[model samples]
Target: MTATLDQPTAVATGVVVRPWRAVLLRVEGQWTWYRRHWTASLLSSGLQPVLFLAAMGIGFGSQVRPGPLTGGMPYLAYVAPTILVSGLITIAVAEAGLPVLSGFKWKQDYWAVASSPVTPGQLFTAELVWITLRLVLGSVLYLVVTTLVGGWTSAGALLVAPIAILTGAACATPVMAFAATTKGDGHAFAAVNRFVVMPMTLFAGTFFPVDRLPVVVRPLAWISPLWHGNELARGVALGGLRLWPAVGHLAVLVGLLVFGLVLGRRCFRRRLVV
Candidate 1:
């Protein structure tokens, strides 16, 4: 017997579940794109962090004494985890930017996928997965440099790369999902950077402690995934974190991702529907 176009749909409704097809599409696209131009990819993800680490950690760290991050830990050690988080932040934010806009407007992949067997939820899943991969890749390079350059003080923090990526995606996915809702022109992401991310990057205990910020603003830092991630990552790097704090940080990351996924799926549905 021959199958018609609706046969796949009928079969799926009856008994079939595929969780990550959209995710595979994203990862596969990254693999293909990177294969064609590996150098630029590395430069953007790897080299960029290395330079930032050199200038920020090593260069400036010399003047500062072993401070709060170390409780005796060097300033460089104190700051490495934040840089690691920064790399992931960059990648996650990028996933929300041009590519998302292109998918909606230029490439119309969001529309194209809808005509296929994919659901908006699946697309959301795929995009989040892809963003996670990109963030992770960027993070690992930064971590390795932290180790090689002595910015990372202990072996424990070696595990922080995956943690950082998860946290970054927790933050970025919802932001991207929000971006997906734009009809045509969207500056929401730029606004996020200028108002949201940039503030988090500076005051969310990345360079200085969140305690240093004003009391009113300090409460807001609690809402930043980067701050939570940076704290966990730096503490782990310094061998300074308790188990409960680590779990708490991870929990926040999970919550953010869930929130983003739910909202992003809704946004995708609204934006793609003609």
Candidate 2:
């Protein structure tokens, strides 16, 4: 008689591990790698936002006077929160794109881990947890710099951290799902940066009001997670956050997050299981 060992048989024999435990183990592995090689991430995710704020908010802002355009605040204060959110979205794109593709295709790390007891859903969850950690750390650093550079207008600006994290996760999860479906040398990721990331950063109310955009193009901003995040962050930071509007913005971000999680899990399962 020949016998085969598998997860189902292991579970029957009382060797089951909890799902969250598996997810945490994967997250720990990611953290271990990141701890050893976090400098590049720090450069893009931490320092880049500060450079953007200095250049756009202080440098060019010096030439422009605040008025209806700035929502009646200093340009630095007006643009700071949105810039933070946009920067996170950019980080999300980078994290969720090539790295995700590499896990499945170039590196085949997902397959190697799948040969263990870890499931695809756990892997997807761990990826999200790691991305969220990056967003949280980046947001904190950006907020600290914003406060130091006189970009913060209210104590409520502190709330931007959560908003930025949500915005990043919303962007990251969907891109992670897309990356799972991609093949080749990750050329699609470049197109994503050019078409999706750049458009969202430039037109999604990051640097200016969406209403300032051409009427035909305004809908693009409305669909952007960055725009929703920007609105929430600016409202709380600069004051004047209306109840219904805040709820609506939260709903949009939450919807995107839920949608991405669903799609990302399905994609991970499809790729890893088969």
Candidate 3:
């Protein structure tokens, strides 16, 4: 007998029995979509860090003298770790915003996923895991470019990958939760970039130290996750981090991740399981 037009052509994998497996399957779906359009993504994602490094760390850095502002290090090396962290934040913002809303409002793949036995929390976890994976891979590439550009100074620079990933995750989770809650068009995403991401990138020590900011507004930088991540990256790469400060920076990232995850799971359920 021939199957009807409504019948699924592929063989069934059956219900995903384990929670971990369900989450992995959802991540696999994300990977499949990425694999198809990876070339276009590479043009933007791959070249961005390289271009940023060349511009800010090389060209602009040449004009900057090594001084107290730069901790006696060349501006290139001084800014590279922070630039790496900032790049991850850029990518995280791009991924966590419109694409997440699209999964719900436009493409509606999320609704299809919701029909499955997978819980909304697992779906949220998979998205976070995928974003983390992107940060991990991007960090490796950015570090390589940093080395090639002479921006790498210490052997400890290798540690910047985890620091950058944590920083990116801290930013991404909350943005994803916000995206899931937004009901309108791309305007909301644009606003996120304009208001949230842009301000943080400019003021969160990506190019210079936050201490340069006026004392009255310095607390704003202190509360920024990017600033904390940048500090950790710069400290490890340049070798000046005190033990207590490192712990404090870590606590902030972990706290943000947990808070975002709680909100994200709730938002996903509200949107998808409706």
Model 1 alpha-carbon miss at residue 69, Å: 6.6
Alpha-carbon lDDT, every model: 0.76, 0.88, 0.87
Off by over 4 Å in 1: 1-17, 41-43, 68-70
Per-residue lDDT value at 27 in model 2:
91
Comparing 1 with 3 on TM-score, the higher-scoring candidate is 3
Error of 2 at 196 (Å): 1.0
Displacement of the residue 134 alpha carbon in candidate 2, Å: 0.6
TM match of model 1 to true structure: 0.87
Top of the candidates by lDDT: 2
lDDT of 2 by residue, 93-118 (tens): 79999999999988889998877788
C-alpha positional error of residue 79 in candidate 3 after TM-score superposition, expressed in Å: 0.5
Better of 2 and 3 by lDDT: 2
Question: How much RMSD separates candidate 3 from the native structure?
Answer: 3.2
Native-structure RMSD, model 2: 3.9
What range of 10 consecutive residues in model 1 has the weakest lDDT sum?
8-17
Sort order, TM-score high to low: 2, 3, 1
Better of 1 and 3 by lDDT: 3
Give the range of the ten consecutive residues with the poorest summed lDDT in model 2.
Answer: 1-10
Task: Please list the residue runs of candidate 2 whose C-alpha ends up more than 4 Å from where it truly belongs after superposition.
Answer: 1-14
